[model samples]
Target: MDSFDAIVVGSGFGGSVTAYRLAEAGLRVCLLERGKAYPPGSFPRSPHETAKNFWDPSSQLFGMYDLWSFSKLDALVSSGLGGGSLIYANVLIRKPETWFVNESIDGGYERWPVTREDLDPHYDSVERMLDAQPYPFDQKPYEDTPKTVAMQEAAGKLGLSWELPKLAITFARPNEAPAPGVEIPGGDDNLHHSPRSTCRLVGECDLGCNFGSKNSLDLTYLSAAQRRGADIRTFCEVRAFEPVDGGFQVSYIEHRPGQDGDPAAPPLRGAVRARRLILSAGALGTPYLLLRNRSAFPALSPALGSRFSGNGDFLGMIVKARRLQEEGGDGELVPRLLAPSYGPVVTSAMFMPDAHDEGGTGRGFYIEDAGYPEFLNWLVENNVLTMSHRVGRFLLRRAWSAATHSPKSQVGRSAADALSKGLFTATSLPMLGMGRDVPDGRVFLREGHLDLDWDLTASKPYFDRLNKTMGEVSKSLGGRYWASPLWLLNRLITVHPLGGAPMGRDRREGVVDSYGQVYGYPGLSIADGSVMPGPVGPNPSLTIAALADRSAERIIDDHRRNPAGRP
Candidate 1:
């Protein structure tokens, strides 16, 4: 029966950050992650591998993507050791100061217990640890990244606040020129023990950077935790936990590689004891676990499953922006080259002020340029009509050359056009938008599966305002707004799902306090997006990591005072 000073579950932003800090404080910490660790050159790329890249243990699949489809909307989260950072775009935007509304909005929901001032130092610390840096638009090859340029130019025309937000990517070494495929130059703390190179401009951030160009948590915080002797275990999924004398009892199952997909795989049951338990299993994960094990937590807060929000996420597309001639009106339409698949997943951001801003107006939000893996270009470029015409032209040229027996060595241009007629893919841009929407959704168990009762009932106005602004930004680029097909059905997808075990002044208000200590369970804490009282109105990753860092401090303080688990 081995006992740990602390047990951290789910190595996402919250878990990895907290685990490292706790280990650094001299605590014997054991970090548990449900999914496999994806080292450099291991992330799936080909069609066969991508098909199996999802998380479903019952079906014996242990992939990273954990997608949940509810009647209201869909939520996408990761299941790897580094958690969401495995697939996140790497933007490190802090929670806006004004946007952290303390005053209650539409009831007691979304009343944050902590303010930006409280988390500022923590934010700074996290930024340093992640090695955050803005996209090097000032550098050579990166200088002419088409979508980044288009986003900045459009925002200027619309009078919106736009800037290159710091991304968790290693485009270049410190004081070095930004060059593709250069070795990152350091190995003392590299967890993967794999060789890494600088960003190659392949636009594969979301798919998982095979070159290790992204400064993901696995390469940063988790690596530090390992160096500090933290017991980091992957493929170990926590199944149950509960309070006990002198500490808490934790139960989990070891998901061996081949057994992960076997429905009847022999259960590899295991359990441990910990003085303190920290659940960093993310918004959807933590809430689902807590709800399923509610019987064990007799005094758990009633607010456990309340205040679920999608962070006001909306996806919009601007396809084939017209390049108009300056000398004439409505003369000719040429597809502008935005190159949606050239750079990282996100390069620059545009901030739209809401009612909460300084002399602001509508619902607050952020719009960032979204990108995908370059391989997707093949999928998007397969326009039947366009390819048919190109194929016809190439065949006709070859036919004419053969009939005349002419040595037409200049058919190079014709051959090139046959492969890719790139109007749709070259000129299209996807915008990732998220903001402060009404936090009125609920999470509960239905028929033994996690279910969410959420809709746009309270957030319709916010959604309307967000979509309209996106449309204006699209028109600014001489393109038409293309709403997501899911939005047409009154549903949207959210990558930044937040708020489940929300923090509050007390148990009556939320499941945890400002320090992430569960109100009724003192030694048990939560350090993840589940603690967010409302939306962070920016990319939620940095804020989640910052808050977890703050939680680690309070945890260290508590452990020092007690020096032992509760009796």
Candidate 2:
């Protein structure tokens, strides 16, 4: 078995940042990922192929919105070597300034342990690594997408504050790569290494970007970490950990591709040792791992799974179009003003008044532009009119249809056409509403499995506020608003799930201390969204990376001060 100075689990924003830092610091770091390391060409372009892409069903489920099957709420996450970063839209946004201050006493929610002052430098570092930049609105022609034009006009009429969104992308000189180590040049910033190819704007970022334009961790931090001598093993899932005299022992399963004549082969068991352990398996995965290891670390806080929140995120849409200039002709469908699917998942954001302050009746939603890929469009169209209970059947039928008839239907022209229409329509744009979501839920282990019990009723005011804002904005743009029926059925669906093992001054209020060190586990640490205490008022990836960076730095500093302290 291989031994390392540190073992970091998961390869998303948190684990990648920690691995890079630790390896650069001259530590032997091993990153264990439960999914494959999908190279640029490995991305599945067709719906048929992509539909088959998912993590092991025994250990986790990828597409379902519910964290646990029993939960009424909806949560969307991904599993792979780069974790959710593999399929995540690349939008990176810093948490709002006010989000750092304590809001618990104000009847709003839990407070963040570290303030803006403590996290700014880390955020700056992460931004540089991810090539974060503001969208170049002036360079591109603006189109009248439903959400973009509507919000702009609404903000203008209402005199509300707004601006073109910032994004993390490489849109520099056409057909050129980013100059080595040369920061994006002024006026012609190259945010990603793949500057040679312009964002084709295919709107399939979520399915995975075969174009290599996205600056996902696999291309950025993980690549850097590998160069620094970090050992990354993919398709290796860690089942549990046991504390040793001076380090830890990990048990995992090694999965192999199925043979041509056989069904999927059973995963083989394996074990390894490490001087330290870092859990970055994201909010969902991380908690489950810890819960499963409760016997090994009996001192873990009772709050291990308490106070779960999802930033009250929701998705909606508005579609409108102008009559073509020529009869029986398609005028250039309005180009998407916002890079819907090119840049980070969320390039822009807006803030609204807190629902709690408005007698808990207003909709507190942030409206932003989002994009959909061809496969998603196909799914939506085929299942849009079907009854809710029939969705699963519809998906299964569609899957079989594509498999038998058009093996490439997943990437078929229809998918692409729908995506183009969805993004180019003069009156179509996605509205991503995010509001304050209080952490009023808990995660627990049931029969050695993870389960979530979250309370979303308290979030009603925020949802109402978002709907009202979206309605007004849509009206201003001469369009109508439409929300996903899923929201009505499931109550909410969030891409940003945060808070479980939060940071605090002591173990009583949090599972980890201010520095992210576990309360009693000396050499164990957490560097992921699990440390957030409450909603961040924006996308959580940037904040998660910054916090992880800061934690890694602190770990290094602590080791320097006491060589024999913990390990």
**Model 1 quality (TM-score):** 0.95
lDDT of 1 by residue, 313-401 (tens): 99999987877765257767677889888889899999989787877886699999999876688776766786788899889989988
The Cα RMSD of model 2 versus the native structure comes to 8.5
Best by TM-score: 1
lDDT of each: 0.89, 0.69
The alpha-carbon lDDT assigned to residue 320 of candidate 2 equals 60
Model 2: per-residue Cα lDDT over 251-313, one tens digit each:
999876664434556788988887789999888888888988889999998778876888778
TM-scores for candidates 1 onward, in order: 0.95, 0.81
